[model samples]
Target: MDELFQQADRLSSSHIRDRIVEQLYKQSNQLIKAGVTFSKAQHNERTEKLDAIFTSPIFGFPIMLVMLGTVFYLTIAGANIPSSMLADFFGWVEGYLTVSFNNIGAPDWLHGVLVLGLYRGTSWVISVMLPPMAIFFPVFALLENYGYLPRVAFNMDRLFKTVGAHGKQSLTMAMGFGCNAAAVMSSRIIESPRERMLAILTNNFVPCNGRWGTLIILSSLFMASGFTGGMKSIVTTSVIVGIVIVGIMTTFLVSWLLSKTALKGVPTHYTLELPPYRKPKFFDTVVRSSLNKSLSVLYRAIKVAAPAGILTWVLANIQIGDTSILLYIVNFLDPLGQLIGLDGYILMAFLIGLPANEIVLPILLMGYLSTGSLMDVDGIEDLKQIFLDHGWTWITALNMMLFSLLHYPCGTTLINIYKETKSMKWTFWSFMIPTAIAFLVTFAVAQAALLFGWG
Candidate 1:
């Protein structure tokens, strides 16, 4: 047997593998012929029709877009009430904490740091992160449970192959919509080490649940001024869908670049079986997805966000000369931020929001309110008024959306990448690559807007 394997190895690997597969099929067919009816159709007609539509070269992508848009629509529309309730509950709790701290005669700075800073930060994260994750993950898991996820991978396999990455990267990218850190962990499903690393590096391109909350908020605000009725909802959903498509395109572009550069490799072929769709087990899916994906991600975000809240409070409160340290940092970052079509406050928010993407807008609102604390602005109209007061043009909103979509992964995701890759070098590149692309894309957009005098 060893000598026979050595002889087979002398031929081209592809040819040898093909011959082995042919021989195996030949033997299997001989036994199957004893009782099988060769004329009978193998698959159910309905299953075949569904696969034809879902995996069609032309209709496949559009179907995917429609489904994706529907999921986002449901998440955005459904999460609003829950998010508001959570925010209110957290705010009420914060009030009690503040009163208790004062009654205890805690130092003013300590009160600010603990109640106003740390408590508020964690609260904002939960209030913002939980609703979306709770809504998004179950719906996504439903698709997975119904076995449509593998079909998605099957459809995108050709494109990923072109980029020298595994088609399984699509599976991991889908996981990113729930949480990038989870997506990094999911990359283990890819058998190829190089492709797995590629997936980890590019997973940040997709807007995770935290970033989705920001995008949905901004997209709704953008639509509010010009659209109404069902049209408004349609337009808002379309805009978000468009942003998601752009992220996917960016993922492809970056994958192609990496394939040709430091991570050069040939794409490995793998078979993907599209399982028959079935009724999703609702209760099991909901329980498992909520506990496994939503709560797990929320816990990580809270861990990082607690310290971030205290740090943000310190920066906002501690003054240097005439400006607070927060303002000074914003001032220093202003020119670059302007070049990318954002303001000092916006940039500052992103910096401090490093702990969790869910906190970016909250931190920005805090800065804009100038209250030395994060304030929950009620309604899209109130949020719009704040932006208008701060001189936010549509261009500013648009560029910020673009930047948010393209920016580096949140701190939790970064840590996950480090742990998964077990290489600081790969992890650093994972950070730098996305940061570079984000700045370049935003800079070009900013320059184009300036040249065209776009609002």
Candidate 2:
């Protein structure tokens, strides 16, 4: 029909696009007419052959739990010695620098900011961040390489759709493993405007690799005190994994709530194509997934962290009324932080961590070391002592982890949300809703803990 052709022409300029849609429609109709069915054994055989335990509800979540545990187990087990080594190495360097600065008659402020602030910041970054990232990313890549990741998506797809989001959001959330900004950008695959916006707003619930590093470290330090040997690793890893899973669950919960209220809609249907498993190329996976992802993200973090480090250093050294600027800021933030089971330093870390979640720990270290010129951390144990000295408790640490998992997208992700939505209102809400939810959830957690003996 001329009219039909005209309408089709208006809808699709490219022949291939129209043809593919037409073909898929035709095939779907044919299957429907045929009353598509397969034997129980046949279905079982298909699922079994695919080795989809990673997607089975009974086994999938447990697999995820184990995988996450293994990654953190490796990170905690691997990072302890290197973290101590780096700390001792850097402390010696700091002493050398301080002496050299005195000999050269360097200005007090100059020595303070450079040797105390910048050097300490960089040292904290290397000692705290390096080992975990080095171990986690490669293991994650191996899972990804083996086609297990898609199974994760498949397992979680139904949950995502129940929230009126694209099922593919599971895949995008998986992308958040490497970076939240990348995950937000990957939302373009969602064709619906409302669903896409939901994806952008909630993507932060999946901890980016940087935040994952922080959670792993903090959980190992704070939550593993009662256990020892392999059990310690298992417990620490389980806690971190539990936190990650909670984050993901929060994403779905928030998405569902938003869809029912502010962003309501039926989810669009899509068939996720599962590629066959292949032997992952070892050298290529290492180069592309592990080294490249880690280094690129680390480089971006250092740029932002360096300036914040300098600022915090200055705040620490400059005293007003016997209290430094850092203390003043922390005092100001403490009341609000109290409601959320965090303190000023924790809040400040999140604020300064705007540039990259990767830098939050580094920033916290910088803040702590502000009064001293010593840089570097001895180990998770030493880091725990520092946090404990500053009034950290199990509730505080748990809520901090929760807040990190639920809070606003990092600066990079906000920029990506803007690019994806091309609307400032959507971008603003994408930041707003998650922040509100993070506060509420954290507040509830804190209150509940205090109400019980748990706090």
The candidate that wins on lDDT is: 1
Q: Judged by lDDT against the true structure, how good is candidate 1?
A: 0.85
lDDT of 2 by residue, 110-210 (tens): 98788777777777677667666777777778878877888877777767877788888887888887789988888888888888888888888888877
Total clashing residue pairs per candidate? 0, 0
Residue-level lDDT of model 1, residues 4-26, one tens digit each, is: 98988788664676588769868
Error of 1 at 163 (Å): 2.0
Off by over 4 Å in 2: 1-48, 369-377
Scored by lDDT, model 2 comes in at 0.79
Cα lDDT of all candidates, in order? 0.85, 0.79
Question: What's model 1's TM-score?
Answer: 0.88
